[model samples]
Target chain A: MSGVFTEEQEELRRYARQWLDENAPLEAVRKIAETPEGFDAAQWSELGSLGWLGIAVGEAYGGSGFGFMELAVLAEEMGRTLYPSPFLSTVVLGTWLVERLGTDDQKAEILPAVVRGDHRLAVAAGRAAVHDLVARRQGTDWVVSGRARFVLDGHTAHTLIVEAAADDGTRLFLVDGDAGGLERNPLSVMDLTRPQAEVTATDVVASPLGDGRAGDAVDHALDRAVAALAMEQVGGAQACLDMSVEYAKVRHQFGRPIGSFQAIKHMCADMLVGVESARSAAYHLASVIDHDPEEAAIAAPVAKSFCSEAYEKAAGDTIQIHGGIGFTWEHDAHLYLKRAKSSALLFGDPRYHRAVLASRLGIE
Target chain B: MQVVVCVKQIPDPSGTYTLDPETHFLVRPDEQVLDDTDRYGVEMGLQIAQAHGGSVTLVSMGPKGSMQGIRQALAMGADRAVVVDDADLKGSDALTTAQVLAAAIQRTGFDLVITGTESTDGYSGVVPQMLAELLDVPALTYATEVEARDGKVTINRQTSAGYDVVEASLPAVVSVTAGVVEPRYPTFKGIMDAKKKEVEELTASDLGVDTSLRQRVTAVEPAPEREAGVKIEDDGEAHLKVVELLQQKKVI
Candidate 1:
């Protein structure tokens, strides 16, 4: 079937498929997931050299001058295979936010390095509710003291964006992992593949991205990030549903394939509905983020709510369809289920996003 | 040095080519490309120009719609492209097309020219020799291995029986068969770069070439349907049918 892409976009799709078949095979993904850093540096560098890392960045910043549509295509492919890399953290969140909020010097110094895949960044946005309400400050230098919990890949990132309280408002402060008075510790998470951590800052040295209106910039960045994550969730959930349907077609019960049974068929059909609905919401959210961020801010939470629920339902449905073998520790179904839950809560849980949607729309 | 590669866009030949019952002409979609065999010629010319530190210009003669073939050649590493588009040039026989191509090549003062031995449609495979005669230059046909070094040329030509390796000088034309090098797929970046490439268009008036050829497409009709052969279930049955058919035709 034809996708909603031009011939130029189709060329990129073909190139990416061929490149992955040749370079980033299943064995490569497996080996990288087994590594300490949980990503293959050499393969990341290869993608960077191939100009994929800069597909959406501006040409003035050494990018291809494309848009988020192209990046979304690549991200969906990555999610299809559960690519084991910090690509989401570095490429989607880190590089995207830096491009939007960084100073000219910051853009010149940091954008190229990230484009070259020399450094990785993880944003420490999710934290205790108290820190989210306001920012704290000190005498000559601003001292941000707070703990950010549930930071995605927080331990592995070289640079961290620590959301803090300032005298003016809530602001995002840049903190190095190895900076003085910063404590980085891993959290025991359900998803083993993508690790999370809690970061504590006690007078940590940080450079404020901007002096004023940093909160709004970071808030807009988070909205876009949530939209991207929703798209990835749709891909993951769809992959799970696909795998489950394939398994049902082969696995037999009472001398007949289970997929022929009405119960199994109905379950699979419901999963399809959830996946397609999530896809529609996710795609709609992506379309609005570029042209209209305010509308995107409202649509993003709605997509986040739907996608978070869809992935969790799809993952559970996939495990149930696999029956006895799925309950075993060796089975991979549980891994996907764990990832679904963890990913759903990465930016905001469905409930948190529902509340945000209600407040944004002035609906009580 | 300026090298020219003849590129023709034909329908994707890998798919089944069927004749319409109403039109005997080849059924081609309104799309263009560097014909499969001509892509090898273009790649070979690019290699020669790169080794000789010269320039390779791709030339394609078809409707203005055929400039897509030239752009594809440029993305395949050709330096530039020229297109000869004319309404009168359409439906010209092999001899007439060769005469116009010779005029276009002469306009550029090309040092060397390369082309496919045959187009998927025409299959005449006579343009190189015909153009060579018009230009009065040495022409080598069915070249499998071509080498150009220090202004000298050598080619291995495939003949009906065996092969003939011959030596030539500069300012020659070579029509190629496949087995030069596998054509390269355009990189993700090359698609973007091809948009900036320049393709010049020339008409028959610009070339001062006359369209007084004897043969022209007066009419077109579809050929008859090809019959599907009977499937033999076993090797013995296939051998017996083959022998019987040959015997009935009085072959042996």
Candidate 2:
């Protein structure tokens, strides 16, 4: 029977699952999460060497030259493992923005480094409908001033792509991480696997990403990022369901396994429905985004909204199913719960995306 | 060096299995995957080919439409594959399998042959040796580590106590053990490129091999279900009860 994914994609999924199971198990994730950087440089380089860091990058830029579908598979696997890395910030947001809007010279210089895992990138843009940073033309340069909150991996990125309001329209500017007038404070985030930061730019000298307005390009990149994040949510929801089912089968109470109970069985069954539905939505969005940009505009918000709620409900139900053990700090359930909550709020929460979807469908 | 790795497509070990009552053979599931043990041999072959400036080829003998597992191994960087698929091969013994594989290997022209010590489902553990004997080459079994240089193959053969360093000339068969070397995951490029790689399919008649079975299963029986063990709840004198039970079963 034919499936939504290709055989090659399925093989990629298996390969990724096996690699993550060995290299980034829960123990390694916990160790990396506890570190201040919240990422392991060695592991990041290893991922680059394995060609995972460049799955979606063009071959001209020293990447694998595959499309976003392969990236979705990698993202799902990363989410399943709770892999502690700046992949979203660096690969999804930063590199995409540059590749979408950067000049040929910029792409030639920066993308190779990003693919090699030698340089990291972050986008200093707040939530949708919000533009905090402002840029003004200076002598042969642009000076940016504003505070952008919830900047994913902002503190450790080698370069920062700051979305700022210009005199004519909104624009994207590239600033060095250690620019003289820039300050980044890492936030104490709920999701330990993904780090966020507050970036304050006080007249940081920057270079314009492209010669003109960047609103459309930024929106396209955001749509792609939302689709990618939805795929991750699907993986997280599936993992929560798997953990619940496995636990229910082994944990006995009152001389019978909890899974044998109708109530527990129903809960597990509901989780399965949510996870599979979310997976369908996410996979559909990934394909549309690769093939048709017009279809992707509508599919992105639908997937984002559905997957966010699915993951949130699955994570919450996972905790309830496990009873007291799931509540403890030692267990891995809370980690996923935190990830679910944080990821739902990352690009935009379910409510926000639902509104976006309604407007896109001309219902609002 | 032209390294050839013998791979098998077996039903997923995670799936439930049953024996066909009348035929006394395994009712193989629709889902099949590359045997876990053979992955080591493929990885070893790839490493040898990479270091010695050659390409690795995969050879397998199984029912038709079992190419999914072969495709998986190809995605792991094998240059090409040859599959011996024919209906007549059903219930073929290990020796018959070796004969068919030897023909395919000869057609592919291999300087060295690598295989897993045993297939997971059958556990015959004799196909590599049989192939070696049929092809008139020295067999090196249970290799934990293998090296090819100077027109010879050297291996650290695994044993119950320790490993033995064994060496043989070119055109040898070596069976590698699990954990010999970590298998590399297929990269996206590798997966995409595998689609265009060559997969030559042949039948038993084309290979000039007889499909008659030398060994066959006469009867099949399900293993007896395990009985529940006696449970002794913890009490103040639970240790004494446990000791008494152990003494009743055997002397403490």
Q: In angstroms, how far off is B92's CA in candidate 2?
A: 2.4
Per-residue lDDT, model 1, residue A336, is 69
Worst 10 residues of 1 chain A by lDDT: A126-135
lDDT digits (tens) for residues B79-190 of candidate 2: 9999898878887899999999999999899899999999998898999999999989999999999999889999999876689999999999999999999887778788
The collision pairs in model 2 are: none
Task: Report the C-alpha displacement of residue A138, candidate 2, in angstroms.
Answer: 3.7
Provide a comma-separated list of chain B TM-scores, one per candidate: 0.82, 0.88
Q: How accurate is candidate 1 locally (lDDT)?
A: 0.75
TM-scores of the models, in the order given = 0.65, 0.91
The most accurate candidate by lDDT is 2
What TM-score does prediction 2 earn? 0.91
Per-residue lDDT of model 1, residues A1-364, tens digit only: 1344556665565556546755666566556666667777888877787677887778788877787767766666665556767777777777777787777876787778777777778887542112332345555566667777777667788887667666665676667778887787777766666766778778776777655245466667677677767877887898889989999999999999999999999999999999999988888787778789888878988998999999999999998999998777767677668778877887778999999999999995
- TM-score for chain A in each prediction: 0.90, 0.97
Q: Fnat of candidate 1, please?
A: 0.10
Query: Which residue runs does candidate 1 get wrong by more than 4 Å?
Result: A1-7, A126-146, A183-188, A250-257, A323-335, B1-252
